[model samples]
Target: MTQEKLFASFLLDQTQGVEIALRAEQVTEATHIQGGIQKLPGSVDFLEGVMHLRDDVIPVINLKKRLGFTPDSYTQEAKVAVVSHFNTRYGLLFEDIKEVFRVKPEKILPINPALRTDDQAISALIKVEPGKRAVELLDLDHLFAGSNIDYTNEEPPHESTAKQRTYSRYVVFSSGGQEYGVSVEIAREITFCREINEIFRTGIVAGAIELRGRTIPIIDTQALFTNSETTELITDEHSRILILSAKNCSVGMIVDHIKEITTVADDSILPFPYSDNDNVKGMLSRLDGENTILLDVHNLLCNHVEAIKSMANIGNHKEQEHEDSDTGAHTVTHHLITENCYLIFSIGKNFAIEIKDVNEIIENDHVMRVPGASGCSTEVINLRGEVVPIINLRNFYQFDTKKKSETNKLIICSAHGQTVALEVDKIVTIYKQEQFYATPSLGNQLRSKKDTLDRLIEFLNDQEINEHVLVLNIHSLIRNHLQLETTSRQAADLHADQHADDTITEQAKG
Candidate 1:
């Protein structure tokens, strides 16, 4: 018999009730934060602040604010739930935790589409008792990454077995006679492609289209599918634009036509072939013996834009390589590993950094704003009494700038012989050599464990790392990006320079 699991139910406000369906082993700590949370200056509203919990400083998140609810007054009755997964930890604030109940997996149901949004944080719904409103299930990973999740029933799946299985609903479309589908959750709404102001010389950007009083960039799906610079898409009567939301950015994709929404069981989705380079998640075989290509819209957009940027900088990157070697910015041969472990982390949906030069992972390091450092070089954090510069790789990498929460972490490492830190959304997983295989720089892809590296490349945009973690060259990161001094003494000088006005005033008075 399958073991029943325990779920913790809680109230966000006085009205709506929610539940976290994770196993008991998943929760690390659940208690009222002593002395309350300390607010950080300039932090986002959803981030309450950092709290010293046990040995680590944990970021406490305001669940109400995170869910777009009105801010609730602080009270001692509130509780903090610390959950850990993939070696990453975060805290979720609750107004009042209700009850812990054991439930068989089959009892949980997908929330009705009529009552949910594709961008909602709730992952599933559970019926605690008869005729009661189902408690929404929260997905902590999506919540921490500031990702929108859809957990509604579009078309109910055919249950073939007694075992519990998770399913996703997708909207099918076709272009160039080829069938394609995208998760209905990410694909917000479908509408006719009209009044699109084509931007000449903008590469793949078809033009700006007004979406609910806001102009957003639109990309041609044909260009994305073919991995080309641009494609002449006939946006006549049948052409439709799929509005997609990933992370904090929203984009529109021009498709021939959206067919219908269908539910497919998770197990039926097969990985794409190794040689295929398109942004396909999997292949779903239908009853009529036809297969539809599952599209990963987020990766499709990211890869197309990145490829254009890479091609534009072809000559510049080669020139920088020689300079990097001369300046000793190249990673030392001794630091390279053939068979070892890597710490994988993500900045946004598109890229995951593989840390080969990781020195240590620490939390609660107080970040001090650095003087004269603009853009990515924003602050210097004190790590074990040593000052290390903090670089938000998202800013350096030109990713979508979402509201950052306190749960974000600093990855400490040595770059150019200097200790530096890279701030990432979350630490995904620590993958050993056998778990992942390295390849020549390809656009971001995830490898599934069930299949070999070659066969699993087709499943690149599933957004979930299975057995194969994409190995990002840390050497390139240290050499090409992050211009900062390595030593704490040099960082201290920068910090002192930030307060030089006060020193001068004191000297004049003396």
Candidate 2:
């Protein structure tokens, strides 16, 4: 009962003091550690195997490479502990678990005077305060004593209990702070900040949300777990706006608002500690903290569900990803960007902008050069007569295309007003996608998770060659350059206002 003596008559000091003695059926959930393991369980690098639990699969030991540089080994920083006993619950890969106590038999003590037990593996000695700093208690069975294998007992299987369930869809959200869910037919509504023209500078859908009148893609789900949030832009009000739907476009998700959706029954299920992400398939047990969580809705169409039906026929206009504070309306847009540099070239190898927003480099006659295109789509300039969509930065990056001095230009852009022409080879001056921050998507177990811009559109079974930096689509290069000058300026202003109202009705019938 020593979970600090059974939560010491209650309130366990709101866990700020910490406590986890488990037994109310082992108190099943908790997540944070995030990594561990360097090579063990049938190695070959299934991501260095071991260090996952929520369906259990643990075995951690890096307490920061055994307290910083332990005889040299485990690296990726290390920090895993994940313990479970008799019924086995592996994972002791620590590099950082710092604290978690519930002691109380008078702060438990014992071996004093001499200290330093040869091989070292403390497990217990705690104290708390009387002199300050004395936490030793970490002998999760002698540091996993030996780590036996045979993960036999198998769990995480329940198909559909609670009387074979039927009906119950919840999708309330709120990240970094808490509140979450997964289905409700994966929530396809909740929009509000209309007029979002499009800003998907790179993917994970961070640019469309114009509500009722259409236009989707807004996904920022905490910027895919760690991009913090900035380029995925959407400002605030905590910026809600969900949207969802993926078998063919339906993405608007500028989240941070949504909050309710209930109806549990599958006997209030279990299994979902990151469920290894097969798109996080399923799991929604919470009949009041019953634990369980991996319900993700295929990372909300960023998994390339055919690029969400070609970005749902290109942002069915109404515009929302074009912020300015909603001026007098009309999909307003403006761009002359050039950061750290990346309008480079090649969809296969060369890509790394940070060169600093780049806004200067033009060699027109309206560009007009498209005898051959496709290394990643480029070369089709016309600038003034308008058609600009050139991107041959060294044959789209396959590199090796010389001769073109006079400062070799052509990089003009205007975004929503359309005007793409990125055929670089030289002209290397600026660099700054802010200054180097986004760089995640490592061992992701996919399951509904696209929100690039504050980075998060992972998917890479192999696209190496110095990878990670492929963001071209300032809204399909400006929807093929301003859908024909926005349809000939609204048909030449409705044919000059119907020829000036038929010459004032022929001067009032003469």
Candidate 3:
């Protein structure tokens, strides 16, 4: 049974000539700001940068930037709208959150033909609230790539038949003029770019992450952002890494500059798009000033790590060389765990992998709801980038939609040559090596056993390691929950306004 949860419901501005639906937690009431634009430095991705709420550094994003429209001014006179994801939280610097209203699912109508802007982007537009004005019903998920900062707040996850996410503490960074956040949990280490162990044919964005002795997967942040935008990288010599975990997943995010860490509430943020970008989870709460984005950890890892694992076959030759070295030839196979160990997460009856794999158990720190996510997702969380993907377990597994519960968490593990993140109802216990294994027979069945990885082997874990626990195939798992474009069909005349729906979504490649 696939479970579905209404993460949060929010209203967009009608004065903007569009009806937008915000994840319940996406909207927040601001206490200050009026007249006089505040020009803060950040990225095109966000409207501005980190701010302070009473004394805390609250991230503030601009709605104009998100809508692919230019604002007349970013003055302090603007209304501050606070948003939050399930685990992670953030705030939006809006013209007026008070303008936000509610619209019944049936009342939402796509933009008229006159509104058609792009032929490829924009799926559907809804009229929010029964008012004279209208706000664009935004597809926030497809719009914002998950934020970096973790939302789980470092709480342990629970064990259930569905997918779940925990929260954590994290840090945000600045690249070019944009502010990006990441969970301190998944971050492994920080350093400047001297020379990435570039491995050709290793996908579009990838290099190598150095662990104790092994060079794990290192995400190519430059490539990722470049693909997203046609902008250039403006960085300094001192680069930093927000390393969360290192297992079968990538080691860390190579950022331009490191920022300070902050705490947030998980109750207020919400999703943007009804369902779109798997990378972005939602936004955080507004604490007086500035709003930030909550990243989707799984989305980041999925794209970055996939470049290393899916696109490239680094270990094929490396392993063969290692075998030959045993025949008296000279060769150096780095690290103990050759392949990163990945953890298998099941939510809403769907499966996914933590970006990083782990050998030991770590606490998720805090557990809370993700704000600013879409109906497609249950919550937002902070893991890698301090913001990882927390699948709506209910949406995928049992069709259950229970909100705000104590038996949930963000589980971190090592495997699959990188770190993997997963949201869960609860976690059992970690198992030691030589006691678990992955078996091919275990496809997508739930291992009824809890407390140890061994029992999970019956279903969740494979017997590949015999007695050791085996991780599930994430590609298959993510595919289960995520809606894939099977044929790349261009949505014809999407704008209900007139021309098109403003063609907002730029896509990963665009």
Candidate 4:
């Protein structure tokens, strides 16, 4: 049988309005060009630059320029398509990604030899349904041939070393025209400063923003650093909120804009000469020959931590009293808040699952891809002696699968005696619900038979920001979303059978 082939389609030039497609298997991942590409000296014109993606630096090729076309400026919509060529990887810069589509072998029409040029890259044209536009299929091998770019021996040396010095990644941002950085470990995410509810008039606390039902205090970076009695709140398109979290506390610092996410070696950071300023940890030298003030997150947030915690306790007490007083009436509203700790993580959105449901959290490393895996279970990894299928929540949730960051974490969770790893963008924090606010009783409206989310709970974090977190029903997610075997024993048996079949096939070939 002639099987169907999948292709990822994208655009190189929006002006030309031509779609180009690449074999889906060749495309590993696509991501926005964050921070900007670092220019290398004496590089080719088509060789845009090397990008610091996750841990390893990969060379980014401007596909437009390579195709003998004028390259467009890198906009917010610009994306890099990371394509794997044998053991090496190269990122193809694109204007925007369109979609991933499948077509039968018959739909691919070969290009005429008369029309083909010696340096042509498009090997064939993909036929779409009646009125739709045709897509040009790219022959990556041919396109990259004669480029004189070495693809072999490009593996990062740190991967083979056991005692390689570790570097801390930082999210660098600007506040008051000065660049500052915070460890990516504590940096949750960067978001636009919008619709902040100015309920708090406390020093440096501008207000709070309600994010996914959670209220997080927004600290005015300018006011806090300048020691101003009042916060000068300014709203603009460029203003961004850098969300930082440690332990149970979460706060957002208003920054002018996010510069880049860069890695800095621990030993390379120069100590701040003045000891009186507890907020400044050290100075990190940037590639542009400027120093970025690395802020000590703990010390910077120390003053407001207690106040935020106290407010949460007070809110919880008041809420409990109100609930107790209204108990006499038959009310359908349910406000259930437990002291159980839950681990919060982000896929495309923030979700919280009971911490007890999680076995362990580990960095995503050395994941073995599984062919024809069911549902979102496209990969598997060996955890101790057990084979755990890795489930991409983003895929299951129909979110765009971007290039995996170094900070991406795999949550090993077991339910119904079946173990699986849930891949998440990053860990937000471990949250313990201290209080809960009553939400409108959705009854059965919010839930369906296959709903993975259980219920929503609104509470205050240590910063007293109202947080609404959707509690994930891990049991439902595992049982309903994951279409794998029911039990771990069944999964193990399946793996064994596949292994045996592979071994037998190898012996037969010999």
Q: Which candidate is the best by TM-score?
A: 4
Write candidate 3's Cα lDDT for 120-187 as tens digits.
12435544325653444445444445545322223333465113433455455656556666564554
Q: Write the per-residue lDDT of candidate 1 for residues 1-510, one digit (tens) a residue.
A: 666666655556765444444444555545566556777777776777877643356677787777777655557777777676555556678764444455667868866657665555677777766486567788665565653221122333346642577677776778888888888677555655778744212446665565544445677667767767557867776577777775345677788865544557788899866847566789988654557998776667664443232222211222223325466665423322212444556677433443344544555247788877666778888777887878776776567886677557777766556677878876544333334434533443322111111211111323454343444455555555444323444688888897897899899999
lDDT of 3: 0.44
Superior candidate under lDDT, 1 versus 3: 1
lDDT of each: 0.59, 0.44, 0.44, 0.71
Off by over 4 Å in 4: 1-57, 63-71, 75-164, 274-277, 310-510
Which sequence of candidate numbers ranks them by lDDT, best first?
4, 1, 2, 3
Residue 183 lDDT in candidate 4:
83
Q: Write the per-residue lDDT of candidate 2 for residues 1-510, one digit (tens) a residue.
A: 443521100111122332212221221222334433335656322123554443346544343333232243444443333345666654433322222223467776655435735434453455645586444444444433544553434565477642465555455466656556667664544534545544333445454544434445555566655544454454565455656665645666555544443434454455556645564545665433434354566663444454344334332322323544657544633222221224343223434332122333455334444564334343576544666566554553244667655444555554555456665544321122333444455334211121212331122322333334444444443454235444666798899899999999999999
In terms of lDDT, which candidate is stronger, 3 or 4? 4
Model 1 shows how many backbone clashes? 1
Candidate 3 runs further than 4 Å off: 1-167, 201-203, 209-211, 226-234, 285-289, 303-306, 310-510
Residue-pair clashes per prediction, in order, are: 1, 65, 231, 8
